[model samples]
Target: MSKAAFTSDSLESTFLAYTRVLSQYREYWDFLPFAQFDSGWSEPKVAHAMAQLTETDIEHFERDATALYQQMVVLFPEVKMLPVPELRTQTRPEVPFWLHTGIGGRKLTQIQAFVATLPTHATHSPQHENVLEWCAGKGYLGRFLAFTRNSCVTSVEIEARLCEQGLAAAQKFSLSQRFLRANVLSESATIPFSMNDRAVALHACGGLHTTLMTESVAHAIQAVHIAPCCYHLHGEGQYRPMSHVGRANDLGLSREALKFSVQGMVTGGDRIARLRQQELSWRLSYDSWRQVHTKDHLYRPLPSAPKSLFQGDFATFAQWAAQQHGLTIADTEQWQPYLAQGHKLSVQVRRIELIRHVFRRVLETWLVLDRALYLHEAGYKVQVELFCDYQVTPRNMMIHAHYLS
Candidate 1:
């Protein structure tokens, strides 16, 4: 794999490149690093290279994925080049004070970035007269589009509470916006999409966004603008490809693999980071201890613990976790070494994950391209590009498509 920019290539060519490379090395990024302590590298030299990484090296790799990815080219030359596109950001619109009122800083930023790519009130043509905001939470996006674009807006959301709030806000603002409460996934859900409507969704997760495209295609809607998130939240645990090329290639994406694609997003502040590290250390220690006693040598998932569990130390958390799983722990005195061992394992796991993290964007690109190619196959002219800067949101890939006619 030499350096090749997929952005300059055709969708089919880019898809083929990713498929060939990913198929060749499916063993690397397709598995969970935390599930087992084994690095699973066939080459002893690769294993030795990983073992040589210190905590500082691990931290550096985790923080800067690009640097790590470039370094990985030395070991895995087959993946020397990737088909990741250079993402482009849309020019943001000047939002009114009224529009910015209740929205959080991040949400407002994302909404502005998303809305910027859409047709404004002055630019709305006869073919794209109305707006349909799918999975509208409180209809903030719908209201923004209605006010800025002056389109007849229909905000469809599952939650009655959000619909009511959105309706109230629309009325207060005197905007031509209506909120409809209906589940997008339900067969009986009435969607008010007309041929002249341009459907938009900011960050509809998994099947929610998929449903948007399916419904839009079925109704022959004028256009669709969407930024998809949460690739693993599909109703079915597995990801079947949408395009003919994708279906033919058949990447065999499990739910775990889908989840792995989006796991590289930045976490919250220092407190959250510390708490996460603490939890990881405890969980790994327990797994290591359990494997020794039970001789199963497999990862056993524990139920999500309460935040309050973290206020106490590792031993207390382990006790609660063990009781939940019908397992017993050794004496508290014996736990000290295991706690240290867990920390050591945590560093090792993080190092292992650094290699896997390089493919995070690659997997996401494949998924996004699958959707884009699906639209293209359905007689639509589709453009897949970044709607916002990656710093604002890693899930910034937007699919903007319109009927070929």
Candidate 2:
């Protein structure tokens, strides 16, 4: 294998360096509900812009403000960016006509994207007798691999309904792709990987993928390709580091901080942005009202509400939110300041996020680098890269590990 683009030492150094910076500003970004504006954390221009910001500026803030992201630029001049599409290392096998017909446009795109990454992914290791698919929703990739590579595929999925569907599809094609309905997270879920096996997980969420890696090492899976998604999911309230180096690091990321790693969005359009802004602002406002009544300064995360809740004015949303938590909503005039403070806080929060945004890829890369390091420790040569463009999928990064004897 060619030299890895970033070695374990380099990835950890970048991670530890940025982790140091993030910890330095942890108090500013964490506890968003009560993150007071501190002039010390923000530079003069940043502080000034934050003060000038109002709800109206949400639409056109970037036009008037050029230096908002300047601090990030200065701090991380050589930061490794993400979302670069993976190289076409292996020429794609001709897809059967029927393979392209049944799927919807989005699913079709995802399948094709997964196909494009496989050739490059396949090049990293020796061929195996079978493929072990993890979190194999509908077994799309397994079906394709079994067809193209002529290897039996053992697909593992949590949902029986999806397993039935995927099994039916594999039967239709007469392909040797079989599904096992078992939660990859459960100890009872046996993923039968052997020396002759190569494992692939398209986009396993959080610890489900971690479980796969841990099990792959335990079972001595010869080759593996994994694309990880949803860094915040099923981490037992915080990230359980996958590698010894990661475990030893002083930077301890809470679930909230881990959520911040994936907060950078590419496909979310203006409408989604506005809705998010409104939800956050209203939550801050609700916190203010709740604080005044209960005298509790601690942050309470709100449950996900229907989109319709955010479709109305801040007051309407605030009233609904107040009722949800049994807070007695005072009359309109008294609640205005809290609502306004919420909007103001949203601006400051976004501004503070500007600094954190610089470290988004760094943190994400660190997580995956940890995975790669785990594989390395397990005696596999690992390589990490973007498997698809962010437009095809924001969850584009893939960690490929192959047992090299």
* Each model's lDDT: 0.78, 0.68
User: Model 2, 57-158: lDDT tens per residue?
Assistant: 534433222233343444433443322223444344578789755677665566666666554433223554588888898898888877767768899898
lDDT of 1 by residue, 1-405 (tens): 442323313777787777887777676688865775677777677788888888788766766666887877577665565545545545677767986688998888888888887655574545436888889999888887877777788988989999998898899889889987888898424777763469998889999999888888888887898899998998875799989999999899999999988887337666776677778788888877877778887788788898778778778888888897798876743787778888988877776777677667778888988888888888788777776777788897888887877
What value of lDDT does candidate 1 attain over all alpha carbons? 0.78
Task: State the displacement of the C-alpha of residue 365, model 1, in Å, after optimal TM-score superposition.
Answer: 1.0
Highest TM-score model number: 1
Model 2: how far residue 28 lies from native, Å: 6.0
**Could you give me the TM-score of model 1 versus the true structure?**
0.89
**How well does candidate 2 match the true structure in TM-score terms?**
0.80
Which runs of model 1 end up more than 4 angstroms from their true locations?
Answer: 1-9, 43-49, 64-80, 119-128, 187-189, 329-333
Error of 1 at 379 (Å): 0.5
